[model samples]
Target: MKVIAFGASTSSSSINKALATYTANLIEGADVQVLDIANYNVPMFSEDTEKEIGQAEGAQAFLRDLSEADAFVISFAEHNGHYPAAYKNLFDWATRIDRSVFGEKPAVYLATSPGPGGAQTVLGAAVGSAPYFGGNVKASVSVPSFYENFDLDTGKVKNEEIASQLKEAVSALN
Candidate 1:
């Protein structure tokens, strides 16, 4: 199986990115592709911009990239308790290119932040939106108080209970 992983954030040092990378690697024997939304550089989506510039090559390429994966691992970063600008732009543009943005791929949705909310607000948004975008969310996990729950150097969950929860989620993917 092939898996594509990404954090829905563009920050240079994002906890979401770290969590997504770790989650992606946990799947056994699956080929994984990690994407940074910042690299795509898709401009903000608007009907006017869409009409003027047409489809961006980068956005089209991202759709192609999504099509290549059988599964997806996304860790969303909450910006003002919602989607980040870059990620929202990319998602909007990609959806316009193809309604089935996820291409019916199985997905593991994750979120993390320094605070205790664990980016739950955005994760909830994804849970509601994923199905409409052709995503089959096989699992969803939240890493709350990321700094306290995850070990930066070890790249693993610091708390055993959270680790067990994650293991269960990973098992559901298979």
Candidate 2:
């Protein structure tokens, strides 16, 4: 399977990105591509900007990347209980180019943070709204207290229970 994985964030040292990468790699033998939203270079979405610049190259490239994926693993980084501004902007631009941004591909949604709530609010929103954007959501997982549960040096989940949950979630793609 060609799986696309990315954190819904632009932070260079994003914990959500780490979680997404680790989760996507668990799918045995799958070809995985990890993307960084920061590299897209998409401007904030606005009617005026769209009218002025037409389709953004970054948005188009992002859509093209998504089009190649048979499945997806996305980890959301919540800011104030919702999607990060940068991700939302890229998404907004991509949606304008193609409303069905996810292309009906099976996906596993994840969210994580340094605190106990685990960014569950944004994960819930993503799960609820995915179908509208042509996403076939297979599972959703939230990792709480990211620093405590994940080992940064090894890029692995330290907690056995959470690791098992991540494995089960990825298995849903099959």
TM-score of each: 0.96, 0.99
lDDT of 2 at 9: 94
Candidate 2 has its poorest 10 consecutive residues by lDDT at 37-46
Overall local distance difference test of candidate 2:
0.96
Give the per-residue lDDT digits (tens) of candidate 1, residues 60-168: 9889888899888899999999999889888889889998899777888999889999999999999898889898998899889999999989888889888877777
In candidate 2, list every pair of residues with a backbone clash: none
Q: How much is 126 displaced in model 2, in angstroms? A: 0.4
Q: Give the winner by TM-score.
A: 2
Please, what is the whole-model Cα lDDT of each candidate in the order they appear? 0.88, 0.96
